[model samples]
Target: MGDYDDDTAFLGQTGPYFWTTFFLLNTVFVSTGFNGFYIVFIGASPEHRCLIPEVNLTAAWREAIIPVMSADGRQALSQCRRYKLDVIRNLSEQGLAPGRDVNLTGLEQEGCLDGWSYSKDIYQANIVTEWDLVCDDQWKVPFASSTLFVGYLLGSLISGQLSDRFGRKKIVFISLAAQCVSTIWQSFSQSWRMFCITFLFVGASQISLYISAFVLGTEMFTKTLRVVFTTLGAFLFYCIGYMMLPWIAYGIREWRTLLAVLSATTVVYIPLWWFIPESPRWLITQGRMAEAEAIVRDAARRNGVETPLVIFRRPELQTLHPGKTYTMLDVLRSKNLRCITLMCLVLWMAINVGYFGLSLNTSNLSGNPFMNCFLSAIIEVPAYVMSTWLLKKCARRTLLSTFLVIGGGVLLLIQFIPAHLEYVALALEMAGKFGFTMAFSIVYIYTAEIYPTVLRNVGMGMCSSAARIGSITAPYVIYLGTYDKVLPYILMGSLTIASSVVNFFLPETLNRDLPETLDQMQECQGLCSGPKKKKCVENGGSGHPAKQHEAKSDTA
Candidate 1:
């Protein structure tokens, strides 16, 4: 592959223009983080019970109407069922005064037929309260989250192709506008169905903008900056946005007002279109040398550097394979590529399940939901920083599996923590989040390194799709909490631990030259013959002869 770094070196590594573009493009992640998990607050299920209308009844009788149910070995008022209203009203009118006079449990029970009354202590309004999605309709809450992931799945499928066909800048702005508009539209949703439909659009647009901006920054920056941009810079900005969510949602308890406020913040990004430029690398690929050169020249001028009249070299243009294309089938056809791709899919899926499952389930934790959520988001900062620092020092497979096990193991341990030590459980959950966040960060860099350059994008798209599937399944995992408070932890922990075991089966990628073709791809030597394993170790950990020769040649 030709190095565009050489061709664009005259533009300088850092400058006012570069910093401006970097900050502007990276800020998009803040919005992505904010909007992506807003559902946790928007669809929150506050304390609620059956709505018994104002009737002439004693306070004890009024309280007795809502039956007590045992949950997690503790007594709490049932959200769904109540004593038959007629029976309760008649008893209240009969001058029966105390619980001692009547057996409350013996009374016939019925669903919340009239309606449900919600407590306003935590949230003034949310989808659960506004649409009465409680008891029998409780499934809708998780399904609403699933709807957003469905949109994420759809968006992931098309965003890459769309950005490659159109320009990255166009997709970024268009998706931003769409996200802003759809979010505002969602706040006005009168019905659950409408909210979900608009939310699907929100998911689609939000992810589209995220992916486009990420790619734009990747292509625009030089090699060193590219690593920083991908590894730490963009991710930390995303964490900033994630950290902001709880604070914003904390102040604005109403879901609609929160959505409106989030949408309003996006309007600031509109003027960024003028500041962020189109990717010159992408422009060069499209055979628009004139436009690519113009942009490069402008960058050089901004950086106060001189450039030759002729900027882009012929070899850089030749590097573009406009006629060649690789698909998921191409990745599956090769033995080595298929093994790597399959392992990546499982790893990505498991990491996503653990990561997103914990994120969305923050409300179900045993503390202030706002604080729990903030803790979950804030923990990612150290996780990302640690992962970035370790990327150069640790073997990819070992580092990834160790974090996964640590996360999964901590989550599993949470079940044993006494219920009274709710703070301990919360601390363990944050520890779990820290582990998975590190794994999530490592998997992206690891998966990219594992695949050959030709199929990296396709392989990443496949893994991302698998991740969306996992995210789609995550809400339902949280829904398992209704069955048992510990079920979500048990299931997520088991899956994560099992995935860590699977991680060991794949080859390590640290310090290895990125494979450029199918023949050069590394094989899974975890189960290879002794001789083959020795050869692989001798050749910098590539099992294939072509890769060995390349390693030797580079060493020589």
Candidate 2:
């Protein structure tokens, strides 16, 4: 592989132009985060019960007409039951006092016959309020969330190839437009089915926008800038967006209004289409050398740096063979790649399940939902910082394994806390979230480091698609908690720990020069032979022989 950086050093690696592009990409990422998690709040189930109109009784008596019943054997207000309306109506009409005059428990109870009434204390409106998706239809709410992840799965499978075939810049705008249009449609949806179907588009567009921006940033920037952009710039801004969602939901109150407001934010990105440039690498792959050079020249001019008239033609930068193309089969054909890909898929799925499960389960926590959601998002800042430092110091396999076990173990422990000690349970759940946060942050970088460049996108797409399975299943996992509070935690914890055990089999990728070909990847098998063999290769053996000629980083 040719080192394009050597020929393009004149462009200035970390310049004002780089920062400008970085921030623009970060802005798009921020919106992606907003669209991705907003469903948590928009689909929230607020305090509700069967609608009992005060047609003939005093307000206090009217409220008392609904019989108190336990759900899942846990004491709570019954959401699906009400005193037989005819019985209650007759009693009120006869001027008979309820509770005292009649045996409310002996009275025949029935589902919300007329309709269900909702409490406005927590939320003025949500999907639960608008569509009556409670009790019998309660499962629909999480399935509604699952619908978005289904879109994510589809997007993950197709977006990478689409961006590779089409330009990243083109797909981004198209996905953004699709997302905005579908979200508007969602706001206007009269039925739960319509809302769910439109959210599929929202999910697809959200992932497409995120992947396109990520690929473009990876190809356009130098090493330091790419690392910073991938970590602090894009990711940190995403956390900011995630943290903003609860506040937005708190202020908007109505689900439709919130959807409309969030949809409107997409329009803000349209102008950036004119400013963000296409990936020069992709342009070169398409044999559009002149166009690629023009972009580089413009970048140099913006940064006030001088560049040669023809930097791309240099011997070190001239191998424009369009790079090796890979498909899913290419990954499967190799024994080493197959194991690595499968392990990564399992790990990603577990991490996502734990991450989204904890995220969506916030409403069920004992505190204010907004505060819980905010804390969930806020905790990631430190997690990310810790992950960055650990990545340099710890072996990838060891760090990933340890975090998964910690996260999973904590989740399992949370299941044991008594109901009265809700705050303590909340603390343990947060601790679990913090652990999964670290694991989630490391997995992306680990996957990138594991795959060779040719198969990187396919590998990442496959793993992320697997992750969508976890996400698609996550809402249902939360639903399981209603049956038994410990079920979801047990499932998530078990999966995490099981995947952690599998982590030991995978080779540690820390500090290794990324494998560039199938042959180079074969050398990765030696990772199992122990650090002595790896150290011998790093010192100048068959492994990463190419690194000897490359400039060693001072940071490395």
Candidate 3:
């Protein structure tokens, strides 16, 4: 590709504008299809249902079910045993739920004798099966997350490489289409086995989605706003999902119904089939001159600027032969490239171990798990904002290391606090959340910036796969380490700190235009050979001869 001017550069920044719109839409409804909420489904108190089955608890429980509100006093609701309450209401109306506005005593299920466990407050009690609800099979639910992550690890590795070969825009749509199809299939899953299998396939597609989403965002934007736009694009994830899930969940109580609703969300993305632009960089690299020209022209048209179509015309570079495959070995040979690969993997693992692990622990923070999840995720907005601000001012090393230390310290502090101290735990967890959120945003931008242009996608692929690997193992570690409440958090804290130590060896990327070629990558490492080759500096980027001449001149 030839050099682009300010107008065309601004067009790259504009790419994020388009992504920011649809990405938020996707996050609002679609992303919810993938979650560990099954943790709550099987592992939660029996009051929560996994699917739509009205569990027969008639033989369980023998304690009196207390009513929180009573005309006389806090009276018992049943015949000296637990009684089930179902709140029926008109879908179109409010304030007419069965027990509150109508008689429920007559509608109670037969053989209603069960038990009620008193809430911590004496004012209320919750009915549970008098007999313990056996959750043996349910205990395996968390393992589903591991399986999903394995899918993610596999998909990220595949899709990241595929984008380079197949093109980023195509993969973005394919991943979305795949996720939608998977969720739609999930809505129809008849058993837990089918549910797990469908979700596993869904998991495979999601990592591909994450990879292409970032790839599209970066390829569309200019060097100046690249990190800014990409980080902000990620913020859309929590920004929309946190608010929308509770509303959607409340209405769609059945898991299958919820899955169907999210699957239908793909319809909104379908219009992108028409409006979304093919990635300009992908176009140039693939040497699709005519198609690439039209996209740049359209972007220029939208922005009221002119980009000569010739700039999009094919350039005579080392073009790929038909079916010429890019192998993993190409990624391994460059020392600079190898370091970037290592950093991407390290940063990804540390972030997932910290991000997912903290999200799991945060549920224990408050009485209402929904409120806790939302409130903590809500606080993540400021974290993303803080990340953007810091990215602008701090060196990559300084910002990443600072957040690593801070997040690690706060996570460690969670160990000393009492388990029931919910509010204090919330405060500490939020601090940890803030730090990790920044670290997460930083790593995304940092990995993209550090890799040379040719290998950026595969480099990101390795980083993303590393993250999925961490995510897969995070639950297993948490489940096993539950022997001690503090072990998991403490361990994750150490991982982030280790990431801090590793961040030092990576070069600072602030103010550096992205390295486009191998020789430019060498200059980035302080290995530029000589001064005379510097004459071609104004020529934009060139190959080894430009720099090799400088080495020859230095000998004189």
Candidate 4:
């Protein structure tokens, strides 16, 4: 097949059309960001203790009813247990006072059988407060978050095939509408189970919109612009939305109202359908040359340039196979492609584990929850900016590994900091977040470059599904803090460090042409035989097209 890039080069790198399409598509990330972490505030666990009815007991006795437990070297009132109400009432009736007359510690204790009372200093209402999802039921909170990721996993798997078949623009709007509806549904949920059920749809639709827009941008933009759009344009806008979340939640402390407001804002994006066009590259792939030509001519006209009478060359159209389609299995069937896919899956998973783990754990950190979430979101802006600059200067493999190591190493160092230095701990956490955010942004561009155009969305979708595994596990990692505050950081750091080591095994994609087919795919020259490595070196690390085809046939 003739190269599609050459056919579309006349569109130029910058123009009114390019800028309009770029900004419109990137705006989708903002809404995705808003929904992605909605769980943090909606399911937040506020400080709580057992509910004791103030009936017959004295004020002193009432205060003593909640048992004190030592945790992290400090004493705090027990969240789940309280002194027996009947025993306390009897003791009070017998003219005995707490501590002075009757040793309160020696009295019988029981679970919060009367239910719980939540502190409203941070949140007036949330899932935890609304349903009393604390103590024995606290696992449900993380389970709820995991449920959303399960939807993400499913969405990532399905969105690729659907987008490839239906067209990227169609899927984007469909997902946008679905996300808005699901999020609004979640806000009105009467029960925790109902909320989680709606959250599943929320996750599915949110990720579908995200990946579709991502792929559309990747296909539409020129090579240089691709880097700028992915790193700065897409990610920075998402961070802006992420930063907006805590401030919005801060003002609207009630979870339902906050969710309603966020979901409703998505209605504004519906009109963008007229502004953004279907990817011309995708249209060409489907053999819809006329439609693709029309888009380019329109873009050319918008740029005040004249296009050739015939935009796409005739010979290129003959080589196209509109009926041919590839699936996830195509990548797995080839040994080289399979190896690349496997490594990418693992890398994406590890990156997600560190990225989402640190992100979701913000509430558990040692500062104001809103500030912690805001700092976590805001740090990504510089991270994306630095990554954009470094993508041009550093090798993809080395940069990714370095970022992971830095992120993981700093997180591990948090264990050594004194507990009294909470601000210092927060700083280290932010630094760690900075590292992971950089890695997270880099991995997207890196993975996209590794896969050929025909299988890019399929491969990215597969990797994203693997990432959902990490995201699904992340909330529980944060849940580990229930037992030990430092445990989550320790586990995330160790996994991130190990992932950095695994990254060294993958091939570098810096300064290389985007592979349009499996035959042009780059191999892991760093790990291959000397002769093959020499061949790769001679080809500037883009593996021999003939050998790649032979390898695929051999593996098949």
User: How are the candidates ranked when ordered by lDDT, highest leading?
Assistant: 4, 1, 2, 3
Residue 259 error, candidate 3, Å? 1.3
Candidate 3 residue 542 C-alpha distance from true site, Å:
12
- The model with the greatest lDDT is 4
Off by over 4 Å in 4: 314-320, 526-536, 543-556
RMSD of 4: 3.9
lDDT for 139 in candidate 1 is: 98
Whole-structure CA lDDT of model 2: 0.78
Taking all chains together, each candidate's TM-score versus the true structure is 0.90, 0.90, 0.75, 0.95
TM-score of 3: 0.75
Q: Which lDDT tens digits does candidate 2 get at residues 433-544?
A: 9899889877877776666555656677788899999999999999998888899999999999999987777666654554444544423343444334565356432244
Candidate 1 Cα misplacement greater than 4 A, ranges: 10-13, 308-311, 314-319, 323-330, 449-456, 504-556
lDDT of 4 at 521: 70
Full-model lDDT for every candidate:
0.81, 0.78, 0.61, 0.86
Each candidate's clash count = 0, 1, 8, 0
